[model samples]
Structure formats: structure tokens, C-alpha cells
Target: MKEQFAVDVLICGAGAAGLMLAIDLARRGISFRLIEKAAQPFHGSRGKGIQPRTQEIFEDIGILDRIVAAGGVYPPERLYHNDGSYSDADVMERGKPTSAEPYHLPLMVPQFLTERVMRERLMELGQIPEFSCELVDFVQDADGVTAQLAGKGGEETLRVRWLVGADGGRSLVRHSLGIGFPGKTLGVRALVVDAVITGLSRDYWHRFNDGDMTRQISLCPLAGTHLFQIQGPVPLEGDIELTAEALTTLVAQRTGRDDIQVQSLSWTSLYTMNARLADHYRMDRVFLVGDAAHIHPPTGGQGLNTSVQDAYNLGWKLAAVIQGAPEALLDSYEQERRPVAASMLGLATRLLEAQKHGNMRRGREVHQLDIGYPESTLSQEQPERLDGLSAGDRAPDALIRGAAGHPSRLFNLYKGPHWTLLGYGLDRDAVPSRAGLHIHTFGPHGDVIDEQGHFYEAYEPAMGDWILVRPDGYVGAIVTHENLHALERYLLQVGLGVPGVFNG
Candidate 1:
């Protein structure tokens, strides 16, 4: 019997990860349903930092400008000592923007504002998240997945090709799958709140501590809003109220200042840090993403950014498989992303330790620009050509002049939902052409001129080197004319090349 499917993908959350996946799938014209157990969008100012790598992802998804407008750069920190003295410190090590790396600094936008921007983009693409809709239970077979959803009306069964669990740490979908999320819960608890604070300048992130890391308190002004995100340690012996009055008292006591007061709180929660990773990212047609797959401490601001990139990595693979690509393409998602998540988890934990030891310095590692998939099966490069930007590395941006003498960027050319082929110093006719592949040649008398040799300098390609960039902006393969056939074979294996058809 042929199975009937309701949608191609069923996304079981509406936070950053699910919303990002929804937006990506919608833009690709993939039929999907994004559901959230909460009736409204997330309102807290959690996960406020957007890393530079995620900024690049936002650029590719057509939301970078809106995000930039809604967010601001991280402000310098103003640390107040117990003796009525204060000092200024850098929030993070600042970096200058180069041609290859445009967005070098992390943007400060509250999680709610980020979600709002992504939801608006999703609506523009003709899909709204189904709120108050919960996935009760799901059963997946070789053919497809049968999802039982509970919403306002009642229980409804939905059949979909794939089930994605973007639900957070207490993910119902992941729990239902019985995937073991094994890790330790740190003995750390803090009360995080979004409150209207008075008597504090919004020029800097205010930190209050009496030379004890465990007693630290911070009130950071939230970008795009007049509220401040206040965080203070929760006493181990006492049960503290989460009301605005309680927060006000805590702030006054911690800072030993009568001037600063929490006028009111819109949101508050006791956050317990945990470091956990799923035993498996995928089980059959069911997949885990973001916090469902891994959870990190609120250190280095890696959680939300990592979650957004997880969805970005999986979105294109899902779209491809649904559109007659090989199912093997889906397998690469877990193989490639799980390692990155694990690495980031360790980094976040280390950063948290540094915070506990009174070391609050953040560096380039938190920006996530150096992450890559060099060890994955999808990354292919000649051993001799591995000195420079090798396969699986991020494809850097460079300015170029088009045939009509118009200025453009490599990133601008690679914006859409397609693979990009950069033929360096190669004839246009020799560049393989395909329906879903965008090809551009750079050199003398080529399709586009690398005007200032930025492309040549960045890539350092030989006379006939060809670079294949994946949809998620990672270099897929690097080959020369001698092994150009390897490129076709690689594409066919990844379901990008048409069977029995060769363009080169």
C-alpha cells in the first residue's frame, strides 16, 4: 500500500532552531508544519548573542539586514567593586571586518526579538508556526513517519516524510524517541530576568561582584528595548521568589546600591546550567536539532547560535532528499553537525569555568568563524592542495566585477538555494553546468573579474582549480582538471548531479 503524507517535514518547536528550519524550508518551497506547545512566541530575553557565523547564515537566509537593524554590538562591561569603585573592561575581544570575514563582532539581540524577525520572515514566505500544538507521540517506519499531534481542537494524526525535534532541553519528541541525553547537571543556579530597571545607564553592561565569582550579578541592557536582562546567583539554601519585588531586593542587596531598582519584570526564571549531548541525532526518519541534540551552559553565547546553524545544516539536506535526492544526503547531516556540537559544548563548558575563576574574557573562539567539517565524508580535497582553504572549510567572501562592470560579492552570488561552483582560471565551457548549480569563472577574460585579486588571494587556486561549495556555505570539494571526473562522481554521490548526465 502506498503511504499518504500530510507534509514533507513536521517541525516540533517554534524557537530559533525550529523557526530557522521553517524559514529555510519555506524559502525552498518545501511543505512543512512548525508547531509549538506554547500559545505565543518565546518572550524572554534569553540567548541574546548572535555570533558572527550565525550572522553569515542570517545573511544567506535574507534576514541579516533586519537582524542588524534590530540588534546592536556588545557593549563594554562596567564592573563595580564592593568598595564603591568601578572599572571598565572589554566585553569580548573585538575584531575588524575583512573582505573574507565581513561580520566580525557578535550582535546583541534578545531571543524574543530574534524569534520575531524569523517569524516575520516565515510569514512573508507564507507559513506561520502552529502554536499550542504539541506532538504527543510519533511512530516512524521505513516509508515515512506517523505523528500524533495534540492541539486546541483535539488529537490529530499527521503523516510526514521526516520528523524534526527542535524542542528545547525537555524535548517531548526526543524523550518520546527514547534517545538518551546523558550528561551531568552543574551545581550552578542563577535567576535570569527581563526587567525594567531604573538608575542604570544603558551605555554599558553593568556587573556587580564582591570579588567572589559565585556572588556575581549582572544587568545588561537589552538591545532594541528599554529593558535590562538581570542575572543574579540563587542562594543554595533558600527558595527565592521570582517576582519583580524579589528581583528588586536582590539587585539592591547584591549591588549595595539604593539607586538601582528593578521597576518591573516581564519574565524571570531560575536557570540551572547543564551540559548534555544526545546519544544519537537521528533515529530512522526522526531527527534531533538544537537543544534537543545538545545543551550547553550560558557561556560564550554559543547555544542559540549553534542551534540556528544546526537547522541551517539540516534544512538544505531535508529539502534535497524530499526533491528526489538520495536519502544518503540526509545521513551527512548527523555525521557533520554532531561533531561541531560536541566541540562547541566543550568550549562553552570551559568558558563557564573561566567565568567562575573571575576570567570573563571572550575571544575569537566564541565567534565560531573557525568551525568546519574537514573530517566529514562530504569534504574532499587533494592532499597536496590542503595548505590553504581546503575542502570543508567555510567559503570566504571576496569582491568581484561582473561582466557588465558591476560590483558584487562571492557571498551575494551564493545567496540563493543552490550549489555554487567557482571555476578559478578555468574556461567557462570547462565549468560543469547543472540546473541547480550556479557557476562563475574568475580570472582574465572570465565571467567575472577578481578585480583586486581578493578571490585569488583568498582561495589561492592554481590555473585550473575548481571549488564546489555546499548549500550551507562550506567547501564541498576542490579538484583540478586532471581529477575533474572526481567532482562529477562526488556530486552524483551527494545527489547533486543528475544520473547518467555529464555537463563537462
Candidate 2:
């Protein structure tokens, strides 16, 4: 007898990664089940920094305005000395927004708030995560994955085409797959808590230290809330209880100020810094995502953002494969994302080391705007193409004039779950039209006019240039008009030929 399938994908852990994957799949009209072992939504202020790249993603998903409203820019750090003097320092260098990059600075939305926004969005898409539902075990063969789930209703069995593990650092799915996560743990451990406090101004992030890294204590005011997230190093010698009174004593002992008090505690956790990456991201029909695939120190605020991007990168490919795209397309997920995650882990580890030595200044690298799949198999360009915006690079956004004379952004054209093809200096009638593909021509006589030449400035496209952008907003292929057949062949190879045919 043939195996029965309940859903196309079964996603474990409704954190940033799982939630994102669910949202993307839902928007694309793919069937999926998002499950979480936790009964309630996360309420911690962990992973509060939303990088600019992630902001762009939220914009594409129609949640940027909500995120912006719920968060604010990072406040300047106020360093307090032992003599009672304080000096204000910029925590990160803020950059002006450009046409190519709209969000320049990182936004400070607590992890709980970010997850809340995504959950709300998911609900709007007609799916609510199955809270307290845990994937106890799953076995995969060539056709599908059979998973045993435990929840309030009791144990149940279901089959899915793909099983994705977005469960965090201690991922049962990963452990069940027997993938090796090899890395080292740093020497520092810190206590993090969210509490209401008095005697400190909310305008700045207050830091107290007397030239000792282990003695550092910082309190950052959570945006859009009255709570302050307090963090201090855990002493190696003592067993410190995680309680309001213990935190109050800790603040007093670290700052030597009796005025500042932890009146109430909302959330608390002990954070240990470690950097680890899974030996393999995929095993047969099961895949690991986010912290399941990699985990590192949260020094540069790269953890949550990278995890969201991981889902974003895999989401479209999974949808495509389910809707008749080549199975090989899914292979690019690990090939493209694992290296990026590795690089991000390195950056976070370095930042943690720098923080230990008192160098807390963050630079543009943490923004994650420059990350791309330059070496991926999906990225294709002409052999002669050298300096211009190469394939595998992120497609830059630009302002353009629509046929109705209305001003619009390039991202608006690339927003949906479809491939976008840009034909520069080519006749509108010459471009081929196909289902699941949006084609636009640009020049003196075209569908969209580059009124201010912003598109030209960003892309630097030559006459008769054809740029094919993937559903995930990366340049997939670039070719000249004379070689348009190359674009067609590339599309066919990726299984974009037939409509409504799920070859897989």
C-alpha cells in the first residue's frame, strides 16, 4: 500500500525560523504544519537587534511597518566608571538610508515582540501554530517522512513530504538524525533578565564595569516597553539563584549603587556563549534550519536575523520543488546558507571575544547587507561578465516610474512569490511571458521608465541585458538579449516550465 501524506511539510519549533518558513509556505499556498513544544509564546528580550537586511525581508513579507512601530533604534551606550563618571559612546555606527538600501540601522525589537509579529502574520494567513505539540520521533525514506507527535490530545502519527527542524540549539530533530554539531564553548557565562528598575535614565544603555570583563553589567531599555534587560557575568565560583532578590543584589554589588533597584522581574535566563555548526544541514527528507543547523554567541545580534534568512532562503526553494521545480533546487539551500551561517558564526565569535576585551563598537559588517550566494550553483552569469552586479548577488532596489506614471520601487515589482525578469533596452513585446514569471522592460519605450536613472545607477545594465531574479530576490542569471535562449534553458533546468505540475 502507498504511504499516506497529511501535509507537504512538517515544521518543528515555531521560533523565528519555523515561523518564517510557515509564513512563506502559507503565502505560497503550500500545505504545512507548524508545531512548537512550548505552550506559550516566548516572552524574553533575547536577540533584540533586527538587522537592516532582516528589515528588508520584513518589508517584503508586509510586516516592516509593524516591526518599525514596535521597535526603535539602538540607544547610545553610557559607560559608568568607578569614580562615578559616565561617558556616552555610540554602540553602532548609524548610516543614512540610500535608494539601494532603505533600512540602514538595526532596529531594537525584542525577540518576543518579533515572534509575536510573525505569529500574528501567520494567523492572518489562516494557520495557527500547534503549541505544546512536540515531534517525538520521525523516520524518513525516499518518498516522505513519517513523524510521531505528542500533544495534549495524545500521541498521533502523520506523514509529510518534507520534515524541517527549526527547533533551537538543543534540537531533537537534529539529534535524531545523528548529525554531529562540533564546536567549542567560550569561558564566559552571563545572567540575563528583564525587569522594571528605577534610578537609571531610559535614554541610554547603561553599562557598569571597573576595567574587568567578568565584572561587566549592562542594562538596556527594551524598546516599546518599560522593562530593561539586565545582563551580568555569572561568577564561576558561586551558585547564583535566578530570582528578583538575587538580581537586585547583583545590580547593587556590581554598580555599588543602592538607588538602582530591580523592583520586578519578568524574564530571566543564564546565557552561555558557544559556537557550533551542524556537520550536515540535510539528511534524506529531513532538513535542519536556524539554530538547529548552527548556533553561536549573540554578540553581533546575528542569531535571529540569520535564522530568519535561512528560512527565507529555503522557503521559496521548497515551494518551487513542491510545485514542479527540480529536486536539485533544494540542494542549494545547504550549499548557499551553510557557508553564510559559518561566516556569521565566525563574526559572532569574534565579536564575543572583542566584548570580553572591552571593544564593544559594532561596525557595518554586522548589518548583514553584504551577504550573498556569490558562489552558489544557482548564481549564473556570462563568462565575460566581470565587474558589474554579478549573478548570485542581491538584486538592489531602485525607484522607477510605472506605465501609469506612478512612482514605485523595484522591490514592489519583486514582492510576490514569482520570478521577475528585467529586460534592459529591450522591446516590451520581445520578452516572453509565462505563468509564475513577471517580465518588465526598461528603456525610452517600456513598461516602467527609469525616470531618474536610479535603476541604471543600481544595476548598471548594458543595452539588451536580461537579468533573471529568483523568487527569493537574488540574481539567478544574467545574459544578453542575443542569448535569451540561455535564460529559457536555465529556467527549464530549474523546473519552471509547466504550470500547476508538481513533478516531485
Candidate 3:
């Protein structure tokens, strides 16, 4: 007889995506079990760059401050030639923070550190991921899913309402479901290592390549640590051991400098650039997220950022459905995330090609700030001639005055796991009143007074306009006060209950 447990959701693999989804669910008072095959958390610097858009997601989840404290801006690049000469310049574009976008620059924190921060947040919510727990198999039915899990002690059965596969590139959930991950694996192979090194300036990301640009290597100093991440190509026929001695020799040979010594090694792996997306993100009650749903090159820093977005997009939907919203809500997860994953793959492939051709200057494309679902089924924009904020766009933040006459921001009101209704230039009490819904006015004598007209300008709404911001921070619907019922109908369509009544 196997020990049995039940949970709302069973999340396999405790990586960035898994932990992020776990944190989101935990914060929403949802019961979930985050299981990892490994005995402990991962320790790697593979996905080190967190994009600006992901930072906003982190802010909503209450982990952005910790992430910002643990990481720093990406440093300028120092290019090295075979002749032993080097030049320093900013390789990745940098941007300053603004009122609309607080995290404008990409942050550099090791993947392990990011996971740690997420796990910490999860613990605060009274949930701890089950490490060393492997999912052996699962069977789903119309009701729920029963998953077989194995640990060092014994095997157990977990009955879960839904199963999520965040299990990485070779996802067993996707394989079991017969989802095709068809993509060509590029011939390029690279060795990644994290090691403590000396004689290298920590101020810049050091890159070395031959004159023809065929073979290249880079040693980037990781923020908040004394270690540097060493990336170099691996020969097709040579030994690819991750031992300290092997990495030391590779760094010396690639950089043409014997002075810089790899004193200690922590983590290393051989990675092949493979761009693949699961044919589908959902099959009944089971679903795939992060690397389980898509795998692509790390160029443009899209891999982890896209993975985080996957969890962010799906987390609220899952929570809402479990709370009796609607089963159809889960379908939108695939509809929204799959296209984003495909687009990210294309962007990563293009950036990888640019790198292959010696163009390393990454611009705004890699920032991932512009990625949104303007065509999603959940987006509802009634006005035909729209110029500014519309349905399916990211909800930008703006400074305003709170009801107490104190300075505040839109993001502060939109931070929780509930729908937000913003009635621009309308009566403060005209919005609907209901559970799981927060209403605010953005004009005179309202809860939020736009002193600088920031909300009006950002949303570009006429008088009596209203924008429905979803829990995930995307504009779900935009309409006028006259068509408030249309907003309620849209909410019902998206598995949300209509507010009980309108109060003026």
C-alpha cells in the first residue's frame, strides 16, 4: 500500500518556472506540491540575466526587491583578439528607469540564486518544495489526476486536481502525453562552467574569439559573487569532462592567457543549442510550462524570462479555476503562452544567428518588454479607433493620489490576485462592487487622483472610460461607462464572475 496525498496542483521540477508557479499558487492560498527530482536545489549560473518585463512580474509576486538586492546590471563587454589585445564597450543596451517602467535594465543573478529567492518566498507562504521527489507516472481523468511519485524512502501516490510539467527540456510529462518537440539541434556545442578566477577584471564581460569568429569564449563575472561564468565551445571529438582541471585548461587555451587561473570550480555543463516547442501546452488536466513546453537558445536571455512569464500567465488562471471560476479558463493558458513561446524561439534563433555572424550588440529586442498578447481571446477592445492602451496590452504604472490624499501608484493598487477596474474620469463610486474585484477611479474626487494626468495619458481613455486589468497585469477589457455590462459579459466569458452591482 502506497502512502497517499492530495493537492490542488502537482508541479514537477523545482526550477525557475516551477518555483515561480509554486510561489504564485501559494500566495493565492492554493494548495500545491512542488516536487524536484534532485535532492537539493540547483546550483548553476546558466540563466543569469533577468529581463525588465520579468522584473515587473516579480514585483507583483513580492520577490522583486530580493532579486534586485541579489543582482546587478549587466556589465559592459571587453572584447579580446588573438593578438592579446582587448577593448571594452557596452555590448548589451542599457536603459534608465522611468515612471512607467521601474526596471528598465536587465538584471544579472545566477539561476540558482533566483530559485533560492523564489523558494524563500514560497516558504513564507507556508509551502516548501518537496526535493528528491520524482514523478514516475500520472493518469488523468475528467475529475483530476493521480500521479505516482518516488523518493528515496518509497513510492507514493499524489492525487492532484491538475498536473504541471515544468520538468525542463526533456519533460517526461510531455513525453508521456505524446507531445512532439520538433526542432533542429544546432551543431554548435558549448561548455559552461562557474569557477573562481583571478587576474580578470570583474568590471566587464570578457570575450575572446579568433580572427575569423569561428571559435569564441567568454568569461563573465557574476554579480554578488567572486566566481565568473566561463563559456567556450567544445570540440566534437574531445573529452567534455566538467572537472576543474579540464575547465582550467580550456580557459587558458581559449583566452591565450596563463595568468588567469581557475582556482575553484562549482558547476559546469555541456549545452547544445536546441530550439524546440511542445506541439501543445495543454492536454486535458495536464499541462506543460517553461522548458517543458519550449526549449531555445539562451541568446537574447529569453529562455528564463519566457519561462517565468509562462508561470505568471498560467498561475492566476489555475488559481481562478480551482476557486470555481471555470474549467475553460485553463484553455486560455495554452492559447496565450504557446504563441509567446514560439515568438521567443524565433527571437532567440535570430539573436543566435546574429551572434554567429559576430553581431553581439543586443538592443531592445532582447529586453522582452514589448511581448504581449494583442490577439488573445481574453482581450476585449470595443472602440474601433484605438490609439493608446487597449485590451491585451501590459498595464503600465503611473503615480497618483490615494483616497487619503497621499501619493501612490497604480501598480500598488494592482498588486494583488484580483481583477482591477479603472474608471477613467468617471464618478468614484460608479464602478461595480463584488468579490475578487477592485475598483478605482482615476480622476477628480476618486480613490486614485491622477495629479499629472498620467493615467489619462497612459490609458488614452475618453470620459467615462474603464479598463479592466486582469490579475496577471494584462488589460482584459476596455470600454466606456455606458457599456459596463459588456465588461461583465467579457468577465463571464473569461471565467470570472460579474460584479454583483454598480454603485454610484
lDDT of 1: 0.88
Residue-level lDDT of model 2, residues 1-504, one tens digit each, is 966679999999999999999999999999999999999888999989999999988988889999999989899999998899989989989789888888789999999999999999999999999999999998888899999999999999999999999999999999999999999887778888999999899999999993476678999999988999998778655677877787888889889898898889999898777899999999978999999999998899999999999999999889888887889888898999999999999999988878877778898999998888989989887644878788988888998989889999999999977888899989866755667788899977788989898899988899999998887888999999888777777887677655434322
Please report, in order, the local distance difference test score of every candidate based on alpha carbons.
0.88, 0.89, 0.84
Tens-place lDDT digits, model 3, residues 395-471? 98888888788998889999978788888788856754677788888666677788887776777888888888988
lDDT of 1 by residue, 343-440 (tens): 99899999888777667789899999889998888899753574888998999999888988999899998897788888888887785567677888
Worst 10 residues of 2 by lDDT: 495-504
Q: What's the C-alpha lDDT at position 386 in model 1?
A: 43
- Select the stronger candidate by lDDT from 1 and 3: 1
Query: TM-scores across all candidates?
Result: 0.97, 0.97, 0.95
- Candidate 1 ranges with C-alpha deviation above 4 Å: 499-504
RMSD (CA, Å), each prediction = 2.0, 1.6, 2.9
Q: Candidate 1: which pairs clash?
A: none
